[model samples]
Target chain A: MFMAPPATDIAPRDPLLPRIVRLRGKRREIRGVWSLEVVAEEGEPLDFAPGQFSMLTAFGVGEVPVSVSGRTRDGIGLVYTIRAVGAVTAALCGLRTGAPLGLRGPFGAGWPLEEAAAREVTVIAGGLGLAPLRPAIEAVLAAGGRLVLLYGARGPSEILYPADLARWQSARRAQVEVTVDHAGPEWHGHVGVVTRLVPRARFDPDTALALVCGPEIMMRFAVSSLREAGLSDARIFLSMERNMKCAVGFCGHCQFGPHFVCRDGPVLGYDRLAPLLRIEEL
Target chain B: MEIHDLEEVLRGHPFFEGLEPQLARLVRGCARLQRFDPGQRLFREGEPAEHFYVLRRGRVALELSVPGHETLVFQTVDAGEIVGIAALVPPYRSLYDARAVARTVVIAIEARCIRDKCETDPRLGYELMKRLVPVLFQRLRATRLQLLDVYGAPGD
Candidate 1:
């Protein structure tokens, strides 16, 4: 059975002195996106599942909840694909190797891999949404089940993890179909909304479980498209986001209706979120 | 198939399935078998709308071009799907460049012939319009989603 991290363990450390971690390596994934590999300065590697996020504090700069993008197959370090979008994130992105950053819990429920076993898996990611879904994709592929990933970005230049996508496709680990909303010369792939790729994915809709993570509007449309393709709401999951201040449920910032995105989910069943997702500006 | 059997073959397609036999014959009358070599331009964007195609084999890419950039393929219509519905609409002009991505076979139906038949047979016109609506709606929905730029940065 899946177990969530204890709140006590993930709660901010005194809200003053957070656990310090050191960035071991970093690479620019694409323009405005950086992949940071960090390790605990002292102690075992941070334990996290696919879809979980960590509250990374850049000491004086501030903290932000960046999803754990990847874990080494042998599980040595945690990886985060950070988009330099805001103050905290831009600070984190600016850090160099060996920079000390505070780290918090790998909080939030993860993708339901246990339920995904023996079934075809469809992963739909848009823009930075791919960061959180990367681990799940790796897990699903490692488990040897059929996997299909429908990913979209604004343009070819914005697609994260191009090499990994190519590897996944060449290794036959997954059927990864990528699309861009806009493209220049030299891009031969599909150019349209990510949802357009849904119909082209090979899967048994009735037996497939779809894990979607993207902007809310994208997820909304993706869920509708999946439902249209015959996947029940119960079988489709979404990774939701809000103004998350606390990694635990205490803070109300991440609340969506009655649920705390920090605790009940960053990952939630579409059935549970369908009604709330429709409300404007919730 | 022989020209005499074209109606039977067209009827077998899901798009034409359950079409009235008489209407099917009339549609077949407007259609002619056409082949395109790989990478050939079937039609260019902004060209006068003259014909639409029901693909019989291979793929056709519907692409849009920005003046200085490479053309972007927004959608691809494969065998058994129809392309160039813009030919049937008012102010008719091809909306995107259609190119054969592979050696392709299609039933090319002249817009004038379809318009003439529709004007002569209201029932057939209604049926054709009914079928075309879904295709047009699907395209419109996709365009709406693209316009949303759903993959771009989130709102603050």
Candidate 2:
């Protein structure tokens, strides 16, 4: 049995002070997105599940919650994929190797991989949504479970981890189907929404577990398509996103109805979130 | 297979499920089995739409071409799916290229014959329209999602 990390019990009085870590390496994924490798400056590695996010602070510039994109099987260092959408993320993306930064808890629930054992797993990712799902993909592949990945991007130029995708496809580690919304003349791949590829995936709907991460609208459509394909709501999971402040539940910035995204989820069952997802600007 | 055998196949298809026996027979009258090799272009964009197909085996890709770049596949139609609905709708021209990606067998129905039958039999026309509406709506929804570029940067 794999040893899981102890859950955080005490709410930090100063969540920023004791959380400092150092960035070790960086790799650009696309135009504005990057994958940064980080490690603790003084202690043991941080253990995290696939869907959890860590609160990353850039000392002077503000802090933001970035999902832990990857972790060693031994639960060593962490990998974070950051999109330079705002000031804090932009700062985090700009830092070079050996840069000092603040890192907090690997908060929120993760994909229910234990329940998915021996069952077929379907992973659907849109845009940068692929980052948060990468860890799950790695775990599933390592376990030699039946896996299918349906990924969509803006175009060929915007695809993330092309090498990893190629390796997965070439090695037959998983059934990887990739699509783009649009592409130039040289592209000869699927050019439509990611949900369109879900029907083509080979899985026993009765025994399959689907994990989706993407824009809310995209996930909504993806979930609908999966349901039509015969998967139950209980077997469908989503990694949600919101403007988050404190990594813990104290700050109410990441509230979704009765649940706190930081603590209750970054990964949640679709059945629990469907109703709240319908309300506008909630 | 014989024409009667093809008719039996059509009857078994979900697309023709609940179709009136007489209408199914009429549709079968217009269908001719056609086979395509891999990489074969069944129809090209802007071509005058003459026939639509009920795919029976293998896969066909619907592709849109760009002037200076590669062809982008919009969708793939497998067994039991219909292709070239444009022949049934107005502006009778293919909007994209349909190419067989594998050895494919299809029951091709002449658009002119089907249209003539529809004009003569209002009931058949109504039933066909009702079924076609859902497929059209599905395509519309998929197109709308593509236009939103839901996979792109959230702010963009």
Candidate 3:
């Protein structure tokens, strides 16, 4: 059975220190989302893995652990897709060209891409969950496997990366299916929860690996559907989130039970998480 | 479609997988092929529900209309999906509108005919219920999840 992927160093070298970065570029992704490209002002680009997150600080506003969206290994810099929900995120969204921000460890485990070699890969994302999975999706695409991407959003306007989705659909090896919970008259595409599309995805139950990210409720349904489709807990992986006070394990604020979300996870295999997720209030 | 063809299709449909050949033949008696042009309405809200459909090709959208807004498409049923299942339950009336989103073909089964078959044969009724219940359960579960409003507001 497949085990959880090794975390990219649970604690960064200078765990307490924040590397200052400057926002090199920014773009509005949707109605309330922004994609910001930040580059380290001094050090080398943070070589992060898919599903890892970094502690981002907006001057004196506040700090939040945001997932590394993409460009992790691209040689350029890192990309963080922020939704203006809370204070720290809203501050990060308002930054302009050359604006300064503090960044720390690209922490936690990532999707099991190395072990997934030669296997069919299925990616399922809901809402902003697609951000962290995007790097892995790009890697899987470059590695040339039968890749299927199933994504769901709240509505038509909330759908992210239309250009990228269309481009991925054009790739010979990838099949992309997008659905939404709601759609207006202008949308002629599929309308339903992402899990509904799981039954129609073509993949080998024994050889395919599935990655899922979204709210806990969405992941619960997605995992159940994937299980019904014949995948074992060992073959599925999901990214988890909690209120992480420190980017390191010392704080213990993000502990699920014994493991800390900041260090032990953020990305975890279903086999390790299934039981915890089943508890009444864990 | 020819009775023989319809029986064969029913025998092999995923929804009816493992159904006895005799039962498939009985279902075929109440089944007929239907083709709907793109934008055609299969059934509308408040209409009497006389039949259910198993999509053979193309897609259908389950929609709802608001007083001042454009029709809302809640779900799309693709090939192999069973639609208009409201026909099988009490107060048999379509709750919402189902329209063909593309040139669609389906095996429309007369609900009353099947219900009558189920009445005479308890085992047949049990078997049919065994299959149909799962479909209802799945659709209801999907609806519940969609209603959670996971993305109703901007969230991290």
Candidate 4:
């Protein structure tokens, strides 16, 4: 789903302070996972890049980094898909419609959508990693370009965004292949790591951009698989997650080697991260 | 199916992508089409795995039955993939019960026929082993990944 373009542009607010928002909608995606839609309490729309994240606060429970899953044209509403594994996220997931919460940022760099218009795009996501990549996937689809999606989950029930995946598969330009790590007799889909599907996806490695996000270990394997499939390190992008606070470079809490994940990335190129990714405990 | 058609199917299958025509013909007599209804067992654990199957259509779940708990499906093999690879090695007994999760079709190749052909022509034996080795390695790698529980494991 998409919204209209911004009608009136407002001045950017302080990056540190949180703006209050009201929960407009919520849907349970799976056990312990929720897709939340919120509009600023003052009616200011959230204009964020597809892969950028917001610092969501549950009042007293504290703030956590939640990526923007969807947004409307005028920014009147913002969507986030969150899994309640921690205190803050658990609190956010428990809220009912009209509940008030705090939001900060549309922070961090986003996927390279502008440069990807002419290239074939292949997106590889595992489990909740799809949430951050959802916006970029929608943007690529909206541009009317072809996309190949290879997704892996723990099992059938752990799959996120089933309806959206079906809709994208129905589109002529998108090819979706999903696999699970394991399943019972009831499941007929492919069973294996998401990386196994890389060789099966149809795309020219010479002119393709690969977007990947998921558990750290899964991302590492995906990089290897994409490389084996003939993609260069420069052609791959990943969303790197780390402990983030302050949402700006000043805090240094989200430090990843020399870079700050909050400001320098959450989205980074594999070319630059190759050496770092090889370093243990970096 | 006629010998001509069966050989044609083997030739066209991805598994035989680059096998020599003569080499493919050597094992053609040992091949036949088989189907299993949904929920039917293709092979049971501890049984002699006399034939390895190349799935032409449908899905098969390789499972282990444990007392007092639900069956554990460690892997699900899809169309175009091979199953029952144990037939190629010593103590050729199935390690799991391969059950058809849906109506399925496979090209069953008798292990004895393949082994005999290999003995007669060293090249044919080497070529078949070359292909089967990779499938075995891939399955091993997949099982290792499954044990990691990458999706549900605790980590961002």
Q: DockQ ranking from best to worst?
A: 3, 4, 1, 2
- The DockQ figures for the candidates are 0.54, 0.48, 0.68, 0.57
* Residue B35 in candidate 3, Cα distance off native in Å: 0.9
Q: After superposition, which runs of candidate 1 have C-alpha atoms over 4 Å from their true positions? A: A1-17, A171-173, B4-9, B12-14, B17-22, B64-74, B154-156
Which 10 consecutive residues of model 3 chain B have the lowest summed lDDT?
B147-156
CA shift of A116, model 1, Å: 0.7
**Candidates sorted by TM-score, best first:** 3, 4, 1, 2
lDDT (Cα, tens digit) per residue for candidate 1, span A1-282: 999966685554563346888998899998778999988887476788888988899878888888999975457789999988888889999999999999888889999998886898999999999999988888888888789999988888898899889888875657989888876535556667888888778899889999999988888888888988989999999999987787788879999999999999999998899899778888
Comparison by TM-score, 1 against 4, better one: 4
| lDDT score, candidate 4, position A223 | 92
Which stretches in model 3 have alpha-carbon errors above 4 Å? Answer: A1-13, A72-74, B154-156
Clash pairs, candidate 1, are A185-B70
Please list the residue runs of candidate 2 whose C-alpha ends up more than 4 Å from where it truly belongs after superposition.
Answer: A1-18, A72-75, A170-173, B1-5, B8-25, B35-40, B56-80, B97-105, B119-127, B154-156
**lDDT (10s digit) by residue, model 1, range B62-81:** 88887776777777677778
The TM-score of the first chain in every model comes to 0.92, 0.92, 0.93, 0.94
Give candidate 3's TM-score: 0.94
Q: CA shift at A222, candidate 2, in angstroms?
A: 1.2
lDDT of 2 at A76: 69
- Evaluated at residue A182, the lDDT of candidate 2 is 71
lDDT against the true structure, per candidate, is 0.85, 0.86, 0.89, 0.88
Candidate 1 lDDT:
0.85
